[model samples]
Target: MIEQEQVLDALRAVYDPEIPINVVDLGLIYGVEITADGDVTVRMTMTAPQCPMSGYLLQQAEQGVRTVAGVRNVKVDLVFDPPWEPSMIKEDALKSAGILTDTPANPVEGDCSTEK
Candidate 1:
């Protein structure tokens, strides 16, 4: 049987070319479900809906999940609800990247873009 941990571990190997952190640590992965038959589904989102790497990232994430020993099929679902924010990043990953010393309650007000 395939385990969620194995799926997650595989995704950790997939890095966002635009970001230094892997998809897992980037908090891009929303959830992972593995069927008894080894079909794995991953619900995830990018920093923004217009992210140019969307297709490539989805492919990378799916390929990564498929690398797991028992995964028969990998489906990467892209969602936008509740969107993504700087605070979504894993604590350790943020610290390592020198992005933050402590997680914030609200990192951004609206629109993840840096334009001000």
Candidate 2:
């Protein structure tokens, strides 16, 4: 029987082209289910539904999971009910990217137009 943890590790191999963190750590992976027959089901979502790379990301996730030793089939189901936010990023993942783990009190907003 294929271990669920191994399958999750495989799924974590997929990375968003724009993000430094892998999808799993990015909180995009909502759920993973493995069946007795080796079929796997993955429910996931992107940072934004309008993201142009959504199709590519989904395909990569599916392909990545299939590479697991005993995974016979992979089904990726995308959802956006709760919506994605930067706060969803795991603390470890944020730390790996060198992002401050502490919540910024009174976050600052800079106007990019002034730089020009």
Candidate 3:
């Protein structure tokens, strides 16, 4: 059986084309599942649905995770149901991005909360 930690480590290597940070740190990767046969499934989303590089980025993530020794198959699912907001970013990622502003980058309208 493949360890979940190993799959996470592989995910840490993928990055978004527009961001200087990796997808894991950016909070783009929502979930990861490793099946008994070592197949991996990743659920992820982009900052925006119209992101031109979404295809390329997802492909890279799938390929990168497949490079892990125990992984036999990789599948990446792209979703945008909840939509992505700057608030979803990890604290460390925000700090690294130098985004000290208390305001959310793409505020939706009435949802006001500084805490994520």
Best by lDDT: 1
- TM-score of candidate 2 to 2 decimals: 0.83
Of the candidates numbered 1 and 3, which has the greater TM-score value?
A: 1
Candidate 2, residues 1-116, lDDT tens digits: the string is 88878877987898889988899999999889899899999999999989998999999999999899888889999999789899999999888887755655553457554454
Q: Model 3, 1-116: lDDT tens per residue?
A: 88877877888888887887788888888889999988999999999999999999999899889988888889999989789888887888777778655665785666665446
Tell me the whole-model lDDT of each prediction, alpha carbons only.
0.89, 0.88, 0.85
lDDT of 1 by residue, 33-61 (tens): 88999889999999999999999999999
Considering only N, C-alpha and C atoms within 3 Å, which residue pairs clash in candidate 3?
Answer: none
What's model 2's overall lDDT? 0.88
Candidate 3 off by > 4 Å:
101-116
The runs of at least 3 residues in candidate 2 whose Cα sits more than 4 Å from the true structure, single-residue gaps closed, are 101-116
lDDT of 1 at 24: 94
Models 1 onward score TM values of: 0.83, 0.83, 0.80
Better of 2 and 3 by TM-score: 2
Better lDDT candidate (1, 3):
1
Q: List the residue pairs that clash in candidate 2.
A: none
**What's model 2's lDDT at 21?**
87
